[model samples]
Target chain A: MEFSSKLLQNAVHEMSQLPGIGKRTALRLVLHLLKQPEERTEHLSNALVKLKSEVNFCKKCHNISDTELCEICASTKRDGTVVCVVEDIRDVMAIENTSQYNGLYHVLGGKISPMEGVGPQDLNITSLVQRVKEGTIKELIFALSSTMEGDTTNFYIYRQLEGTEVATSTIARGISVGDELEYADEVTLGRSILNRVPFESSIKAT
Target chain B: MEFSSKLLQNAVHEMSQLPGIGKRTALRLVLHLLKQPEERTEHLSNALVKLKSEVNFCKKCHNISDTELCEICASTKRDGTVVCVVEDIRDVMAIENTSQYNGLYHVLGGKISPMEGVGPQDLNITSLVQRVKEGTIKELIFALSSTMEGDTTNFYIYRQLEGTEVATSTIARGISVGDELEYADEVTLGRSILNRVPFESSIKAT
Candidate 1:
């Protein structure tokens, strides 16, 4: 779409570079910014610049941090011995919200997806394996989504830990707690049945 | 949700302040930027900052422009005697895309809405009135949306121009060109019937 102002065009062009935003949405957002107080735009610009320039990845786990080491990796309260693996910081935030897992996280950044030209080497797998071989961690939990890429990455990492004594396990897949069994996809329902636990084991979880 | 990094949290907060964006979507957008080259984030930040600081409004039409007058107002080919009053620059661009309206535009910045605490004084209506009183514009067309706020703004402007010699009209409201009568909304279909023009006039619009 044509823009009346070159500045507006440039701003929309840059905003539309984002994954899901289209040109029309970008124009709407830029125009919205123009309508708001000038300080709002300044704040957004400053926050992004500051994040890009100063944001750091954890030296130990690869999660984004303000300092050299992320908070989780630096904390003594969290269990560093059991690192829950995830795709990115969003997953880290999601798992953190549940408050169920007290263990630390190892952010792989992304799963291996051949379709997207991302391989094991493109992720943070090397650092993860190195951390595992350094020998303090006792258990590693694969908490990535249950997509094909997730399974592939899990298998690749498991094979890499062949000689190491670290026990690796994946997060369970089942129908949501409040969802009906009939509404569950066939594959998930079948897997839930095959992976059913003893009655007392299910009771222990609560 | 808790964030491991303060910088990430700050960026997400500012990003989510935009209309239609939520915390979850903001997090996803921010993380996407983090995964890309650092220059991508820098470009986006710089573009927004530049637009906020340097963007200018045309002195005549109030449409966004790089110079004193907008391209439409400055052009001799455009019919300066017939000015279209619109809600904002988005409407200007939409009408420009049609290539049907050759007149200049006067953007009102926003429509009058009591629910949003907006009024005529908050818009560019005063400048528009001053322009009409100058007597160069022979006709004024109201092209705002068909919302209650749009109609209120249009009527408010019409009242302001009551003593002026300029003939005033509104953009037509009717079913879309390809829309079937049965599928059209009752109000629009009714308006189309009530405002029916000569058959030759309808053929000329095509």
Candidate 2:
């Protein structure tokens, strides 16, 4: 779109460079900023710049953190011996929200997607192997999504920890608690049947 | 959502404040930025700050500009006597894209929407009246949307120009060029029929 001002056009161009945002959307966002108080724009820009430049990643888990170690890694209350492996910080946040697992986390940053040119070396796999070799972790839970890339990443890590004495397992895939079995996808339903839990164990949750 | 870093949380919160963006999308965008090179984030932030702080509006038409007068207003090729009144800069860009009209524009900034607590005084209506009073404009075309607020704004401006020598007109509302008559809304179809142009006049354009 033709913008009257070069500054406005530049802002829109930069905004549209973001994933999922188009030129029209960028224009709308820029115009919205233009209509608001100058401080709002200043706050947004400053926040983005600060987040990019000064943000720190946890040395232990590779998750976003303000300190050298993330909160979960530093917390003595959490089960440091049990580590939940995830693709990114969002997965860490999602699992944290559930409050179901109390283990420490290992963020791989991303899965092993060959089609996307992302290999095992591209991720935080080397550090994860180092963590396992240190012999502190007892159980390594594979909590990545049930996709080919996720499975590949899990296997790659499992191979790296071959000589280590850590127990490795994946999170169970089954029908959601409230979802109707009939409405479930065929693959999920089939998997749930094949990986059926013990009757007494399922009953104890209720 | 709980973020390990306060900086990440602040950036996500600010990003979510933009129209049509939600918390999840905001997180996705923030994480995408975090994964990219630092220069991308710096470019986006710097451009936004520059645009917000340095952008200017045309003195005559009130459209966004880098100078006192906008390109359209300063151009000798465009019809200075005929002015198109629009809601905002987007409309100016939309009309410019069509390349159908060679006239100047006057941006109203926004329509008079009582539901949103926006009134005539809140807009650039006063400057529009001042433009009309200067007696250079011979025709004023209302190109705002076909909403109730748009009609209200047009009528309000028309009333303001009651004693002026300029002729006023609204852009026609009808079936779009490629739209089927069967699918056209009743009001639009009825209006199109009522304000039907002569067959020869319509045929001449093709």
Candidate 3:
């Protein structure tokens, strides 16, 4: 009498376990998928199965790739002497899409989080240190989020690479566009003033 | 060498085609699926395929079911003399969840919409009229949304059954709970007053 199949309910429950999806939203998505052609859902299923079967981490950067080395690490035009360290493979793709950074990337797999029981030993920091010890990299850039755990992880990495002779730098943090001064918190205001740089080509507000 | 697997990318793209899901959210969901065990995604895929294959519309009321005649239509306990008409199967499910009505149902499949190229012919109106003409149904209740198209469709059905002896009525529309007089629209305010009944208790403000 009920429209809900046990198998369908099981699937919806599994999907709702993912981040940002509620039970109602999961049901909506499952129903939408049900209305689609059989091949569409099958494609997603095959993809899920093939992801682990066909893909592996690049030996050099630890990013998910089909080859031994990822495209960025394998490219000759990239600056191998400068490495941009990120928290995940998604970050690497984001920076690559901007076409602003031509340096090789090293994914830390995840940021250090003591609350979540994830420590430095859980990350690919050992491989990063090994790569730095080889003495090929001239600079290491940290492009992590400005969260507490991200900052703590950055500090830990800095301490590890302090005496290695590799110049370390973090991305510039400041107020974003269309932000209000009154709404800006004290921490953001202090950081903005502390990192203030010279303004060139100044124009009057209309 | 691409950061995303081709299969994952295609699945994300297909999922993004559904209502309310964009590329970024789709990618996030696909990544979450990738992190889970293979059985989880397999279950979802199988459920989607099963949903389409295992369910069909009832021959009598057009309600969704695993058999030719939906459970509601085949139930001897349900009143066949009274039929509640609705726009879709979801509405039938919604009403069933309330467990307040013991009458039968008639699903219109969709309402009349000229702009969207839908008309009276697009619905199962012919069968509804035939059912009414069979002299079995004594009462017909219109349980549709209070939208322009819903009103138009309701009017059309009423006109079609004008000569029939069966009693016709529409569900009362009124202001929802916690109504603010200042914010109440004219249509809702007028409806609340027009459909006003004897108050059993005094209003208590929380």
Per residue, candidate 1 scores C-alpha lDDT tens digits across A57-167 of 998999998889888888889987899999988888888888789998898989999999999989999999999999999999999988999999999999999999999
lDDT of 2: 0.93
Model 2 bad stretches (over 4 Å): none
By lDDT, who's the top model here?
Answer: 2
lDDT of 3 by residue, B59-106 (tens): 889876667887788999999999999987668878899787899999
Which wins on lDDT, candidate 2 or candidate 3?
Answer: 2
Which scores better on lDDT, 1 or 3? 1
Full candidate order by DockQ, most accurate first? 2, 1, 3
Per-prediction DockQ comes to 0.84, 0.89, 0.35
* True-vs-predicted CA distance for residue A177, candidate 1, Å: 1.1
lDDT of 1 by residue, B1-206 (tens): 88888999999999999988999999999988888898999899889989988999999889999889988999999998999999999999999999999998999999999999998999999999999999999999999999999999999999999889999999999999898999999999999999989999889888
Q: In order, how many clashes per candidate?
A: 0, 0, 0
What digit string (tens of lDDT, one per residue) describes model 3 on residues A16-126?
Answer: 776788877776777666656877666656665576456678899988777788777889999999999999878888988878788999999889999988999989999
